[model samples]
Target: MTSTHKNGLSPASVETIAGLSAGLISTIIVHPLDIIKTRLQVDTSSHPLLNSSRAVLRDILRNEGPTRFAALYRGLTPNLLGNSAGWALYFLWYREAQDVIRNLRGYNLGTQLTSVDYLAASSASGILSAVLTNPIWVVKTRMLSTSATQTGAYPGMIFGLRAIYKTEGIRGFFHGLTPTLFGVSHGALYFVAYERLKEWRKVSKKDQTLTNLDTIVASSLSKTFAGTLTYPHQLVRARLQTYDPGATKRVKGPGLVPLIQQIWRNEGVIGFYKGLFPNLLRVVPSTCVTFLVYENTRWALPRMFGNADDDPSNRTTVARKGERAL
Candidate 1:
């Protein structure tokens, strides 16, 4: 669609489309790390051997043989569906929330939205995305841990959900709701840092927009900081998502602290961050790609399609009130 609704595309739809494209591309390129990150977090192997991205890569090469590379993408279908929907909904909610907040406060594109604004918007977006996509992720996690020889795990999204429904009932899809809800704090921290970094760059450069490299640095740093702080919750979430037959017998309460305590007692404190390295490896680059693609698409689409929004001098006419410029 060209600018100004000429080709019938709304700004919200454009943002969604851009997010879908970016998420798919990033997932395709970096998913092996994602797989490794999940496996490491969920793996009960002694001492967490799959610590490094290289180690995971080495394992795939050593153990999988000819299908080694393909093996790395074992859960690509669930991943693509889950991630695509998450990004699309994230941007949708994020943009709408920013618009509402901007209207309430008279925030201007003439000046930037504050980091607080970003954090609030991102927190809402993260929760919405997580709730809607949790089932897909439960299936995805099972797929990731599924062995090539194991016929127990379902083959696709529909089958996986059906199996979970049959075996664990309606509550099965929300296996990790507690830790996942806790993980929304990660988004709050991430967007605050990222938005502030962008603001600082613009002020330092004496410019209205950031260069691509500046965007990358901000996105990477923000991801690393938030990812590291919240990684333990992620480990908890991954473990929670899987079916634990012993959980009912062993764990005392059906609450967050008990889960943490269970993990602590059995696997120790290190269990909560088993895959931090590989997760960081995936987080930094993938986050950079997401913002890079988003920023560029938001800027390029308008200019290419002649939407006055991207005209360097005209901030007011941008499709979304607080849409990132350049």
Candidate 2:
């Protein structure tokens, strides 16, 4: 794909658009598994994590059939809205940061930025987006859990927001801030490794077809590595956001450390990795679809939407094939 977007639209801006498109597409595709993963993760039943997912799924499918199956998409609207906006902002900031790095290093427009550049950009954007969208996630988790367990029914995103705000106040939306900050590393590691691997493939003259198996493998493996490394934080975050009526009686006062200790003391080290199997089953393909879509969209959008060549600045600011312009 050409870097014409980088030339006129600002690479990061176009990147944001691509990220939004990709996020919506992937969320729609994998949300069922996401809801299933959450149910399995937050489950306190004695059944093993993997088995609990199976049992829950089997019970739901057998008893409720079409009704429960329909309920599986409980929080999908907020999930899609949150994810699309979050990803778009993530890519926008990251690519804009990349542009800044290129300027600092005296690199031109189309230059292949280093992994370190990607790391910085991805980490900053990931954390910022996570913090801003944490409320949506909180609402999403609650809605999904409620619908899955047939507990409370949230009329809509607005109703869910009002309920949480009324019950928990502003702080309610930030239920998992600490663990989310930690999960920033997941985005950092994944983007760095993924971009580096792509660079490696290109350097080795292996930019095969657009949606090759290698691209999928690279995206999936990078996500898996990051997810494994940061899996504990995810568990804690889920548990933190998940409200149980009796939680106050079980754990110490409100804090991440207390929650961490509670899990460790109760479930031991294994507590931190609940639902890894099901999560991976969803995540690997979810990431693969996201990256694949992002790449394709970024590649296609320049041709589809831009008229940079007709712009006076673009005509005057020509640079080499792999070099960028100011």
Candidate 3:
């Protein structure tokens, strides 16, 4: 029998809900950091000090006038939509893929999955979610990279999409897709570190499941590790997706290889990590909130809605075991 939450939702549905909720809440809390990160990534100023998070944030607030505070959340609508949908799809696909692999392997209930399983499942899920949601990301990058004072700045997500469609056609929405796909390694690394960290904590503490604090710490560390190593791809992707408000033709930018070469030639290796500081600041807490909310929501939903006994962790043998399956 297919296991369902007490609320009559499948486990996958519950996970999707959790992911959506997590992304929505976390994005709202940390959007200002996102704006800073995006601006820093696209900034090509020769002076390193000019590109610092503090400088960028101060510039926005001091110069943007009435829109200063609001500017911190410039692309909020698309960002919210993209993150909520992306995380939802990622968790759903990841959990389903893990189940498929487990069933194929004939693993018994509550069997611990290997790191290889996590890599495969996370990679597949990341690629699928990244592909499906690239358009929203393109729109978000446009809104964030464009100053509020810019002539062709989009007023909202709908307007942004319509503008891109009219001006750049459907192809505009998939900008930077190549680097985005390559960035899947980031997610794979994150999940592997996350699961392994939880396992290590459980072993050290002699506990079967981790506390909420443990989950937060694990996610923060995992995000740091994955984000630091794979951050260059994000910089490249952001640059490729940057909007040119003055352009009438297709959004023109260097291809993946040439762009990387350009950054290398002009800015050196540090250019690829332009926003690492603010990104880590944003992503670490954002990841903590996401995993914490996801795990807690999954735990609470069934009990709050109907069945108090539907433990999400034990749903399948290959279900994430330690750290409350966050």
Candidate 4:
């Protein structure tokens, strides 16, 4: 059978690798911003006054200085690892499912997948990845959110994970699964919007010959647009994920109602979007780099490997194994 017609890749690999590469590159580039965003969201003390993003920024600078930049990457090791794995798994499953959906619906591959298709595939992938990688993310979030005192002198990701697992058990690792899923729906929305926007840009501009650059720019813009619109959900997700269940007065647990109520009671409705500015600042560039890396990597991979039809199964197998390891 031809490479395209064989079981190799099956379109899922394309999306998976692209997403994974993008996430890795983006994380590395914007990790510092992420640290700032996390600190702002998780700060519970009256000293910082959560209302002021500028005050939060000033505090980090005054107290931490350039050293604070290090805080930007507090959980870099696990976050990059987890993010890469998460996106890869998300894409693989998303693509595989999309393939099935396409087959059932009689959609032509050359015409591009639809938004609904992208949404369904990405949603399924997001949920699966959230469940599988919750532990890593939980550890990462804790490391990102807490101070040395709060963590009892634990300094790094390894110690952090050990402490949480030992103290809180497996359930602790899934602290914010619900909000995380809610937030990750943005990822689905992101890809779908990205794909559709790219297509529209290409068609409306009458540019049938699009390049990797075009794809990257289009994908970035779409993600930035969608990310900004849906950013409050992300703040809520982060807050929920990093909530300290063992604190003196704990916030609410999982589920939308309890989470909203707790945040409103403790920090007010505006609290739901506390770190939104910093988050937007971080997410836009992060997303831009992510799609750029993903699209460019995807473009380069096929050229490096030659035609898609040649040894498609081998390519798919290798890609799948690599994704699982991510």
Candidate 5:
């Protein structure tokens, strides 16, 4: 397809819809794994790292009985809310940044997008989204990581949201914002790497169709690499989010630095990566599915939603032969 007619969707809308769909679908698919990952990360015990996946399953079966799927999806509500909001914002910001960069660089619509441009767009979007949605994520993490005893209902997403608001007030929602922002750096890195890898794969194969498999591979590799590199921050974020403010006085909330020091003193460096293996496994597949779904949805939405030029939401004044703005 030529640049003007390519995909027939407005770039902006395509990105937004793709991100929303992908975030929602991927969250639902992988939420159980996510809950497990969170629990493993926040355990804070002196015991050596547990077999995260197995432990998660065991805990679910033991506590919730055989029908433990409900336990697995403990925080589905907060996850859906956080993920959908995060991805939608990320895509919108990323596309806007790309447009600004393209216009400033005087790049034509048909010109092949450079690796630098993609990285810049992805990083900007990821960081912005991370900052905006950190609070929601904090609440979600807290809800997911806590035991049923703490939550009183094995809490769905709504329960978590209500509990936070009722117990801790609105500020409680943002408990882990600092660590979450730090963790967002990982996301920025992941997106940049994913885009570059995808470009390399396409160039090597001389195929630019960006197939489903391609998206999956790119997303998995990118998330794995980035997730591993930045895992400590994520662990810290989860810990801080789930830390009980009302716990006994012996448990001091000394904030981020002290917590890090305490964890280091108590558990050592390996402690930071308590759930790394399961996280790697979960994140790779989850992210891969997410990006694959996102790209495909972007490709399909124009056909389903009508032409980009006619849609005011698209904001494209001129259409080239095979190019769509996104």
Candidate 6:
């Protein structure tokens, strides 16, 4: 049976809450970078104007006029919703999967799960979360790609949702889903490496508790490693999401294979790594902050509003040490 905290939240619920908080905090901190990254990814043309980050920022400012700064946050609403819900669902599912695996293996709270176990759990949770939240990402992509000064631009997330549904049906919301599923390997790699790093630190330091600096290092290294390998998929997904075959005479096919072919034909291997610099810039700090918030929130939630003892995973190392000393 799942233990209930004093506040009537289960361990999984606490994880979800922690995840939501982390997502919101991180998104707010790095959303402008996200905008820059997305804009860079979706720019297929070789125009001199869109060549660099400075150029993109200048273009946005010039186009957006008085509210130029605010224009940087064009897709914030859907991004916030998608990221918050995705992280919440991911943590809830990941914790549940970990619990099930631990129980099946007859492992206690003190026992660490293997890297393979972390990979499996993280991949499953990440794919499910990615699929569930893809529609929100599609809307956000559309919002980001279109300028506020554009005549047919979506005024808000609701309008974007309505427009896509009314015009393109349900399939519209699922654009880039194939690449997203493939991108699940990013999360798998990140969590596996992160868990291994944390385990190594615990063993080296002889301490079960990780400091914030520890978390930041683990999260940043893992994110950079995973992100570099999987970044091409993100570029492909952004391209696919913003590509409107009906509106543009440039392409006849709307499928992933066709899109890949087009990008290959146009830009070769370098095309896949477009926006990679800004993406790394955006994701490193974003991952660090997210993990920091997530770890701290998870640590604090039960203590403040629930019974700390209710969470086996959150049991104090001091208590474990005391028990061992006895």
**Top candidate by TM-score:** 3
Ranking by TM-score: 3, 6, 1, 2, 5, 4
When sorted by lDDT, best at the front, the candidate numbers are 3, 6, 1, 2, 5, 4
Candidate 2 vs 5: which has more TM-score: 2
- Tell me how far the alpha carbon of residue 124 in candidate 2 is from the true structure, in angstroms, after superposition: 0.8
Among these predictions, the greatest lDDT belongs to: 3
List model 5 lDDT by residue over 73-107, tens digit each. 76677789789888888977877887788788998
TM-score of each: 0.86, 0.84, 0.93, 0.79, 0.83, 0.90
* Residue-level lDDT tens digits of model 3 in 1-326: 34875446667777899899999999999999998889889988644733488888888888763676687878899999999999999998998888888998899987878999999999999999999999999999989887777777787899988888888888888999999999999999999998888888877774355788878888999999999999999999999999778666664678889999999999998888898888998999999888888878877766566765654655421223354544
Query: Which of 4 and 6 is ahead in TM-score?
Result: 6
| Weakest ten-residue segment in model 3 by summed lDDT | 314-323
Off by over 4 Å in 6: 46-51, 243-253, 312-326
TM-score of 4: 0.79
Q: Which residue window of length 10 is worst by lDDT in model 4?
A: 312-321
What is the overall TM-score of model 3 with all chains considered together? Answer: 0.93
What are the runs in model 5 whose C-alpha is more than 4 Å off?
1-10, 46-52, 111-116, 149-159, 245-252, 308-326
lDDT of the structure predicted as candidate 5: 0.71
> How far does residue 313 in candidate 4 sit from its true spot (Å)?
16
Q: Give per-model CA RMSD.
A: 4.8, 5.9, 3.1, 6.2, 5.5, 4.5
Error at 8, model 1, angstroms: 5.4
Clashes of each: 0, 4, 1, 1, 13, 0
Better of 3 and 4 by lDDT: 3
Q: What is the lDDT of residue 231 in candidate 6?
A: 92
Residue 273 in candidate 3, Cα distance off native in Å? 0.7
lDDT of 2 at 313: 22
